[model samples]
Each structure stands twice: as C-alpha cells, then as structure tokens.
Target: MSETRTGIETNPFDRDHYDYSSWFFWVEASEEQKAEQLAQQEQFLRVRPDSSIGERCFISPLAAIQVETLTLGRSSYISGHAYLTGTLLTGPNCTINPFCVIRGNIRLGHSVRIGAHTSMLAFNHTITDPDLPVFKQPTSQRGITIGDDVWIGSHVMVLDGITIGDRAVVGAGSIVTKDVPAGAIVAGNPATVRKWRVPELAPPTAASVPSSGPVPSGGPVSSGGPVPSGDPALAEQLRAFDQMVREQAEEVLARSWDAATGRYVDAPGHAPSVRAHCDAIEVAAYLTGDVPSQLSREEHVAWLRGLQDPASGMIAELDASGHPGPRVTDLSVDDAHYHVLCVGYALEVLGSSLPHPIHAVDELGADGVIALLDSLPWRGSPWRSSNVADMLGTAVLWNTRAGTPHSAATAAGLFGWLHTHVDPRTGMWGADDPRSGRLETVNGFYRTARGSFAQFGLPLPHPERVVDTVLAHAQDARYFAADRQNACNVLDVAHPLWLAGRMSDYRQQEIRQVAARLLADALSHWRPGEGFAFAADSGTGRDPLAETPGLRGTEMWLAIVWYLADLLGVSRSLSYRPAGVHRPEPAGSLTSQ
Candidate 1:
C-alpha cells in the first residue's frame, strides 16, 4: 500500500506493467474522465527505480525523468515532456508544468505551481576569462529552494541558488536571480520584488509540504536525516525503500557467488576478481547476515590463501591454470596494494587472517619509510600517495596477529611523514588548484587519510578543516552531479565527511543535509533485487541497464549508504556499521598499540 494513495487504488505493480498513460491523469474535466480509475503500482513502474514516491503522484508517460534522486510528494503533478534530471525533492500537490527544464538540484514546496516553459538550472558555468569557451569552464551548484504555496508563472527562469519564499508569486517571463520574499509579486529580468501581498487578505496557511523532497530549511547546504521525512507517510515509504535495498544485498552476493572457486566473479562469464570477492564478503558481513554463498569455510579460506605471494606477502589473482602468476595487470583487482585492505579485511570478517606476513616493505625503519614517502607524488595525485598506507596498515594488522615488530616502526615513520606534509589550510595532502580544482586533492585526502590515519586509529591533525574541504567540494557541479557521480567519487566525498564527523561538529547540520541528499541519490541508482551498477544510465558510460550490477560499485555503495545514514544519526536503522573498506570505526592495530 502507498503511504498516501498509489496512482491506482490497487494493483500498481501488476505483472502486466500498468500503463502510466491509463492514469497519466484521470483528474481532468468530468465525463471525459471515464478512463480515470485509481491505479496501484510500484514506485519503479512510473518514476525512477529505488525511489520512495508518494501516492496519487501523476507523472506523464512522456516525462523525461533522468533525475537520479527524486521523491515526488503525495498528489504531485508533473506534466509531459518535463526534462527533470539531477536531484529534485518536492512537497505534495506540486505542479511541474510541461517543458519545465529542471536541469539539476531543486527543491519544491507543496501545492506549488510552475508554468510552462520554466527553466530551473541549479549550477552555473564559470566564465571568468573572455578567451575561454563556456563549455570548457567548470560549474558550481548552490541549488534552488521553493517554499510552500508558491506560484511560478510561464517562461520564468530560476537561476542557481535562488529561494522563493512561501506563498510567493513569480510573474510570467520573470528571471529569478535573487531571493523572492514571501507573499511578494516579482516580475522582470532579474525578478525583483514589486509589492508584498497583505497578510490579512492572504490565503489561509496551507498544510506544510511533507518533506517528500524537503529542502534544507535553513543553515548550511549539508544536514543529516533519512529521507526528508516531516510526514508519517514519508517515514513509512523510507522504511520500505530501505527494506528493498537490504534485500538486494542478498541478491548481489547470491548471483555473484562462485561455488567452484569459493569466490565471486564480476558476472557469470567474467573472470573471478580478488577485490570483488573481498568486497562481496565485506558487504555480506556488514549488511546481510549468512548470505548462503554455499562455499565451505575451508574452501573459501584455501582459495584466498592460494592467491598470496609468499615472497612479497601480498595477494594477487591466479592465472588460467589456477595458480598465482607474475603477469602484471593494470587493474585495481590486480593491484597488490589494494588487495591488502579489501582482501585483508575480507579475511578478517570471515574469521581468518592473511595467510602470510606482509613483507612488501618489511624491516623498514623511520628513515627508510620517510625516504620512500618523500619520493611519492604527494603534490600530484593524493590517491597515489595513499597507496602505501594500505601496505602499512596491512603490515600492522597482519603483524599484530603474527607477532612481528616491523609494523610499529613503519607505521610510526609513515605517520610522521603524513603529519609533516599535510597542508594545514585544506587539511589535505595538496592545496586546491584555486583556478579549476576538481576536488582531486580533497578526494585524495580521504583516500590517503583512510589508509594511514583512520586506519591505525590516529586522529587527523585538523579534522574540522577536512569537513570544510569535503563539503565545499560537494558544492561543485562538475564532480558531485548525477552525470559525474560514480561509486568512487561518491565514496570519496562520503568517507571524508563521515570520518571528520567522528572528530568535530563544525558543520554538523550541513553534513546531515548532505547525508539525506546522497542517501536518496545512492538509492536511486539501485536496481531492486539486482543491486547497483558502477554508474547509472546517465553515468560516464558504465550503464547498469545494459550490463550486470558491478561488485565494486554495489559493495562500496551499500557501505557508503551506511556511512550516509550514520551521518544522519540513523545508522542504527541500517542495523550494522560497515566493517569493509569504508568502516567507520578504526582498526585494532598492533602498530597503534
């Protein structure tokens, strides 16, 4: 049952795939409305999958809904050919007129009326230099928020960062560049206020829009909460959506499980991946319990141990003959260092340890490790610099279990280098590129910090600044938008904010808002019982519709969602904290001790 009203009174999810046109709109003029009957359908049939849409929401069959994260309020009306993409949250009874090009981040209040040919673009391109092409410039997102009982006229253009106050009236042909005052009438190029409506003559206050797609009421852009739920109906819908996501975790593991090799493959025909196997195991342990992979503990452990290189004490993939080979491959699964965390943690979750001590960089003292850390491309790609942290963290993890001394010295030396090199201003490995910084360094900061600082239970020297950089980077349209948000980038933004949350509340509410939006965004990409893809249809070429769900994306996103919920203080709702690559709690390391 829908929280309010399924477009249909019943059977919305008929195996027949109910025709949205049948209910595209039954609420028009009378006698002609004979075709009007209640339609009961699943949220996915009409809108995007993994959404929590309210009842009686009439979205035209022809609506081009590319919005990754959308939550339509009860009785919301979106007319045909409305190009809605990116992330949009709407309160109930909202009317999105035909040809409304809502290009990106936007929030709408209840009973809001948007006229035809209106355009709301949440990000603007940077055109600093006359010589530079506009296409080449970067875009920034401040998002647009519309208050309750708003009325926007036809041919209106709402630019990025505009807020239309409650009961506001935007005249046709107006261009809204500044904030619209409540009960005011605005018309003109820049959409300035002309006169305020008298309060006495104003319409009685309508019910507040139920936070179906609630905008950040006030405060920083980021805040935490599960599904903008100011209504009981929305709260119920959030629970259902979450239940569906949890069920997908089981399907993800079951489909990818390989009984023969006692591991998981990317898909049916794809070769087995070391990282995928570990990712699946971590996901299962953290989110889904006893997933029934059917591989005996001995069989699984043997397969894992077989991948280890005794000489290097690192794990690798087996060749066609089922034995570890020395062929260098340019894949993350083949990257021995990554396996240290993914594989090492996977083993821990399954009641085992790395079969051998990590001698990858063994016997290194303070000077030796310092010299190596100094040589890395710290200023270039922070991601590259973080690679050694995995080896070092793994050294501490495995050594503590195996009772070795090398981990302490190596960890101590690496910590010193990180502290000495970390940029105080951004609290990242490198400074922002002031001109066109694509959040590479900030993202790298998370990757690097995760490996060493967060890995060994060490606090970042400036955790507050880390939150600042991560939140600021999230406002940039180039990286955080729907088209650009892949599993890795989403993880990069999510983890740093989550890690910093443990240390400071500098922007706590801002972090919560980010948590709510991103939680909705990640769920939007979900494929129901099928799990997630590395990218959505709007993604950078990795389409889940054409291919099977990716293990890396599915696992990481399932974990990222936990982090998002944690930020919202609803992580207990997830029922478990991630113990895999994105674990919140620090590892119990011998080095730390």
Candidate 2:
C-alpha cells in the first residue's frame, strides 16, 4: 500500500464507517446479521474490557485484532488484514496499514505512519531454558514505541523492544533493532543512521538594489486568500470575531491608553509600557487597513518621537513588556533592534517613516556589523541574538526602502555575516542551549528568520531543517497544551511553520494538519469582550510571564489566527489579514539567487 493510502476499496476516513458497532459492511448487513455482529463485538469488548477506542476510529473486520488492552486514538484506524495482538496504545492520527503485523505491547504517537506489510513486535520469547521448546518459553513484554511524526515505509520490520525517535524516517524494507535517534534517516538491515534529517541553515539572499540607491517603493507584503469554508456561519463568525476584537480594541484604548503619555498600556492597572504601544499599532492595523496602520497616527508618532534620544537616535526599553531582545545597547543593541520592530514598523504602518537613520551613516562598518553579530549572547541567550538579527534586518530594510546611505551595502554585509555564522546542524542561530533545548533556539529562529529571511522574501538557509526542528518542538506534550500554551510560544511556532512552508513542501500536508489543529485550539484563548489572553486562562500573569488577556496577546494571537487559517486555506472566512509584523511577504528589492 502507498504512504498516501486512504483505504483499499473505500475511503476509510468516511465518518459513517468509523463506527465499529457492527463490523465491516455493517451498514449493509441485514438486521439479523447486524445483531449477530453486535453480539460478537460486545463479547470481544467484554473479554477485553480495557479497550479505549477514540472517536472516528475504524477497526476492519478482516483484520485479526486480538489484544489484552487497546488504546486506539481519534482519526486512527487498523486496516488490511492487520495482525494486531497484545496491548496497543496509539495517539491520534495514526495508521496501521494493510497486511501489517503488530504484536506484543506497542505504543505509537500522533501521525505515526506504518506502511503496508510492516511488522512491529514488542515482546521477546525467553531463551533462558535452551533445552525447552521455543514455544514453551514464557514471553517478556518489552514495549516498542514509535514517536510522533515518524514514517515507517512499506515492508519495514521494527524489532522487539525498539524505540524510534520523533520525526525519524525508516526506509522501506529496513529492519530496525537499535534505538534510532531523533531526526535520523535510517535504512538497511539492522538500521543505522544513514544521514540525519537534522537542521540545515538557510542561505542568505542577495540585496539587488544599489548600495546607496533607494529601495523600490512597493516591497511585496505577505497575505492570504479568500478561501472560504463551506460552513455558512463562518462568515458571520468572522464578522463577529472582528466586531468583538474591535470592541475589545476600543475598550482597551479607552481604558489602557494613557492620555497624558500618548502611549497605550497593555491593561488598566499595569504601568505604561513600550510593548503596549507597539502592540496597539498591530491591533489597530489589524482592525483597520495595514496602509494607515494605527487609529491615530499623529499622536502615536509624536509619542514615539519623544522616546528616541536626540544624540544616539536610540530608544530604551521602557517597562517590562515580557519581550526578549539583544541587550547590547542602552539604545545601542537591544533597544535599538526592538525599536526597529516596534517604532520602525509601527511608523511604516502609520503611513510615515523612521524619524532618523537607526544607526548613524557609516556607523556600522563591516567590522562593526560583525562585532554586533558576534556580541549578541548567542550561547547563553539565543532569543536576544535573534532580536539583534531582527533589528539589523529591519534597519537594513528600512534604510533600503528610504534609499538611505550605505543601506544596500549594509544589507550585503549583514547577509554575509549571517551566511557565515548560521548553525549548519539546526539551521538557526547558535547551538541549542542544553539548558532549554530546542524550545529557546527554535523560538529564536522565528525572530531572526522572520525579519531577515521572511521579511525580505529570502529563502531560509535550511528551510527543511528549520521546518523539522520547529515541528519537532511542537511534539513536547507540556509545551503545546491548549490550556497552558502561551501567545509567544504559539506565535514562535506558527510564524516559523508559515514562513518555512513557503520555502519547502517537506511534510507540508502534515504541517497543514498541525496548523488546523492549532488554530482550533488557539480559539480557546479568546476572552470575548476582553479579547485574547497571552496564555489560556492566565488572566493575571500565569508564570514569570504575565500572559493574561491584554493587547499584546490580542495582537500576537490575532496574527497567529490569520497565519494558521491562511495555511489551512480558510483565511477567507476570517475576512481580514495580518498587515503587522507577523505577515509573510516575499522580498521585492532583493533578488533570489
């Protein structure tokens, strides 16, 4: 059977056939035959009372499923005369293809694709008594677990007590005996890692415009289509969502906006923060059009101008907004980069431009640029390094758009430095911090990639590797829980998937599924009148980070909703698109090499 196999004769995914109350062709069976099949199924259930079958699961009548305990998950099925015995546990979206033999205790995670004629045995016959017949020896249950998003090709035989790691690929006709590491591509008998499906850094794109010339006027902006859903209420729901968001925004402005300071605080009680004001632009732009981004541009611009220092043209981190960035400057590195995003982009959306060149003309020489890149705390804090990248990318881009002095040359050097330093293994910045694992690094990848690569329409250095890594991070059970998943984490994951999806088609269908699920889950974060919470149900700072419902959460999550919906081809239902930082646009000025 093909990896793309839906069903042999019928679409096994048909909801009508998902029910196993009467057995195969149960719908067509006579009343008497249906009753008989029901009794047989009842007897099977009674014998194995530990079975926990999820919704929309299909267990073919032809398949020989004799098990002590079974935990088949939703949207998963057993087909093709499969020989399944003993205890079996599988997460959602798994498939045990036709003619497969799964024996003993087995555990499979979400989206585990077991191809046709594959066999996975989890127990071994005790060989202590060599004199005794092999059949007479007692069996030991050593469970076999195939991790999430794994692909076991046709005719593969996973040996007893084997554990295949997440996002791994087992070639067709291969035998897996040893433990396969995560992100490995293994083949041959007694499978060994042939080549790792690890991260490969994306290459830097060339800046085509002249060094001192002005960037072309119309740089492409990323957006999604009007792909509408069949659901009739979808349009109304989107309109309602918009209205609610508008209501929330209006209420936030009324309550959270500091009339005296001309800045918007996240919430009523919190002190005015730079982040709140920055997020305001997104929320306002999201509601209105992206061209004239904010509600009141003149006031916001005046306020933003006050924050900039006269001598250095730098903006300092005002208050705790729970954002991370390069901590290089008092307006030098960290704040400068962050302002480039908040202040710089906010101005663009407001139908204006940055008041001054971010870094002075010729201030960032080749050596200075390299120093800035190197100075970022890549090892201890990658998130900060990525912030710096965002700042540099934005600075170069903004300059290029204005045709500022040495802007094109600056982009060239910056791209060159990035090309030199990107991690080959992870396709992100720096090595994975053993402290936080891929959580921090993957999140950091978004900040840098979004600004440098996606913002400029440049292909990622290692789009495939980046996609795999980002998708892998989502597998962590605790990190992605709907109740606990935060706005920052989901945005980090989503933007990367959306951006990388534009560059590569590797496992894209799976990516679409993941996005759709995540979009559904993220809906829970909505707070009705208050708008979206940074973290679900964490109204007043869930952990060290205050993720309760606020403007920041609304801005980030609304952006996420657009991205996920767009990826799933249902953005048209939303009736709006992101014109904010989260947008995925191709490079207009820079030519792809």
Candidate 3:
C-alpha cells in the first residue's frame, strides 16, 4: 500500500497550503485585530486633521501622536522627532526644534524657540533616607513657564518650577535650576544673565546726531588684533611684578594687629588709606590660622558686635581718627571718595571670615548700613565718572545682605531701577540723570554694573525688552571691539556677553565665540615673569596702565581670570584625601613658612 504514488504533489492548493492561509485569515478576521486596524486608521486621520495650520506652527509626524492635543499660534514650527507630552499650551509664533523632550505641565508665549535635544522636565523627587535607593523615592511635579520670544539653545535642561521671561536667551548646554528674569540672557548650571540686550544706535534726530568725526580711543589704542610678538622680557617683568605684589601684600599683612576688643585692625599709618584698610582685613583673616567660628553661636556673635558701628550700622575705618592729631580730618567719614568701597570691602571680609550660617551680613545685624545704601542717590553719571564704581559696589553689598523679606524686596527694586537706566547701545550703566533712563548716555555705567551683577545672583528684570533693544544696536561689528570704551575689553563685558549668549536664541553662538576669544586674548597677555599687564599692548606703550600698574589693575586681572575659568567650566585637579601625605601650607596661607 506504499501504493502507486500519486503523480501530483499532494494537492498543492489543498488543505496543507490552505491551512497556512486559514491561520492568517482567522487571525486577521479576529475582533482584536480588526479593532487595532481601525484605531491605526483613525490615528492617521487625526494627525493631519486639517492642512490650515497657524504661522510658526510645527507638527512633525514623530512629534504628533494625538495631534488634537498640540495647539500652536502664528509663525511657530516644530521639527521632527520632538516628543512633547502632557498639555502644550502655547502663545503666538513659537518654534519647537528637533529632538526636544518636553513633559508634564508647560506653557510658552509668543516667538519662542526650543533647540534640539533640550529637555524640559517638570518633576522632582523627595528623598527621606540617606541610604535608600533613589528609585524608591516619592516624586513631585512643578510646571514650566516660558515668556514671549524666548530662545533656548540645544542641550538646555530646564528643571521643574522655573519661569523663563520674555525675550530671554538660554545658551547651549545650560542647566537652568532657577527662575530667569524677563529680558535676561542666562547660562551655566544655575543660569544667570551676564548682560542685557540693548539697541545699537540712538534714534536719528535733529538734535542727537554727532557733529564730530569718528570717536577717538579713550584709554589704550592698539591695532585691534592678536599680539604678534611674544617677548620673554615681558614675561620676566611679570615674574618680577608678582614678587613685588607678594612682598607688598606680606608687608601689609604684618601691619595688621589685634585691637583691645580682640578684632583685627590696620596698625597706625595703614588705617587712613582705603587700600590699606581693605588689605589689612583681607590679610588678617587669611593669617588667622583658625577655623571660622560658628556665626549663630555666642562666640562669633560677640566678635561681630565688636566690629559694628553703633550709630550708622557701619564699621569704623580705624580705632582712632589719628594717632596724635587733635582734628579727626585724616580719618573723617565724610570723605565720599572711598566710603562706599570701604563699606563693601568690610562687608565682604566679614562675610568670608564668618561661618557659613553667618555669611550674610544683613542677617548678622547691619540695618544702618543697608539704610545708608538705600538713601544714597545714584551718582556716577555720564558712565565713566568717579562714583560709578561705588554705585556698583553698593549694589553688590545689598544683594548679599541677608535680612527680612521686605529688605530683600527693597534690594530687588533697587536693582530693577538700576537696570532700567542701562544704555541700550553699549550695555553700560550710569547716566547723568538716572530718571531720564536713556540707554545711549549711560553705556559705560551699564557695562560695569552688568558685570558686577553677574557675580552675585540677582535676576535680570525684563530681559526680553532689554535684549531686543541691545541686539538692534549690535549690527556693527565694531561694537564688539575689545577696547576699554566698549563693553568687549573688560571682564564685565566678557561675563555679560557669555551670559547673553546662553539665554538668547539669536546671538548665542556669536556672543560665546566673542567672549571666549576676548578671554583668551586677555589671558595671553599674562607674563609668567611679570604680573598680568592691563592689556596686550602693555610693554608696547599702547596701554594706559603700563606706566603705573598697581593693586587695582592686578586685582582686576585676578578676578577676571577666576571668573573666566569658572565660565569655561574648568575645575581644580587637586582632591582631599585623609591618608595622603601632608604638604606645607601655601605662601598665601597665614601660617606659611
């Protein structure tokens, strides 16, 4: 019965072949499969529901899952692969670029742009135990609000509970952990505005036009490029300068002595001068060779009280007006020249010398000083006048003061008023009339003030309005000149420009590049042999400070170096290890050999 074989290959179109077809047919015919197919068809129809989209409205196939949930206004565009979850409540004309991951509650205003691969996460975690795993922690949520015309760069990560103000620019790769003030350009880990956006030129009118030729260089003149020659002799001079500085600093430190009240003071002759006073404080604190006393405790509180000025909430410049003289003219407080600087210097020294809890002077008990700062009318008009630095210095002091909520609000308001008068063309502060509030007249003041504010954590009020005005004036490349008269040459300029780039969508790349370049050029001027020169043209007789470089110049260079390094994200290589070999203290330390 291995029978006469069937000549045909067992009904090729019969049960065996039909069974494969039957399997697929039954599976396709199932209710679940039919429902899924119908759902997919519905999704396609929903995504492209209508072709009439608003201006700036962007809808990518990858980005739009439930298209009805995504609403946009005029001139806004969304790039491919941008995953937006939760409610997308937006205003007019915004841009959502490719590869952005946005989740939870979010609200954006007009003309906003979200760069590629940026993450806006509106969620946080609560950790109760020091040893528990992070995944087991409870989660909390916070919404994100972006004001009108905000430009956010690629790789920006904005955390929960943050509000980005109008016309603000977020630089590439910035981690925003706090709220950004309106019209501010904020960058870095906990983003802050380096500068405000301002216009290029003033309005052309019958009275305002300049009658003279091109403005001559005010401070130092150079060919406006990188230094071509590298002089080893200059390096030697720098080394010599460093030695001079070290010796001078040491001499100043030696002159500081303990008072009857146990607080440090400048000895005799050193007490009358502003620099000497500052130096004494700084040096004594460094040389104390003791851990800072706990500020909240009785020991530190008593020490602070000894330094306070009972009448004015200010510290006296010296123990006695003069050693042997009858008149107090030598150490009189009425000399306005350096009074503000002295106050700021003392506050900074006290803050640094105290423990962490007492770092804020306002909280440590200094109401009179705060009141005096508030009462002083804003001077230093026409930008480069003498009192400008004092205005900025006082502002710094106020920002660091720790006090009641009302006090903080007052400080914030002062800052707002100061920023309101910034020159739109030059990004400088200080005008003849603070109330006139014209940007063109106060360019230099604005530039200096902007830098000072960047160091402290004060928010830029109305960032969008400021930026738009500045950018309008930045059309000329000469505005980016690395010279004293312009904002580009000084450290103030660099910091603000860096901040502006981080916050704005329009000039992020340009501003960062310029800032980096300026920093590099300035640092290159540092001679290993001599201390840092005022400019690249120092030895060439092109720098104004070359003939008489002193503490002011040197301090400025050091501060700039420290800040630039910080902005560039450079970190110290040294690490603390309990088991490692101990080394001698640094020469700057109080107990140096």
* Local accuracy of candidate 1 as per-residue lDDT tens digits, 178-233: 66645568899977766655342222222321221122211111122112333344
Error of model 3, residue 294, in angstroms: 25
- Candidate 3 per-residue lDDT, tens place, 284-313, comes to 232221112222222332343344343333
Candidate 3: give its CA RMSD in angstroms: 22.9
Q: Per model, how many backbone clashes are there? A: 18, 12, 44
Considering TM-score, which of the candidate structures 2 and 3 is the better prediction for this target?
Answer: 2
lDDT of 2 by residue, 208-228 (tens): 211111112211222211122
- TM, every model: 0.57, 0.57, 0.36
Q: Supply the TM-score for candidate 3.
A: 0.36
Instruction: Give the worst 10-residue stretch by lDDT in candidate 2.
Output: 209-218
Please give the lDDT score for candidate 3: 0.41
At residue 346, give the lDDT of candidate 3: 37
TM-score of model 2 vs. true structure: 0.57
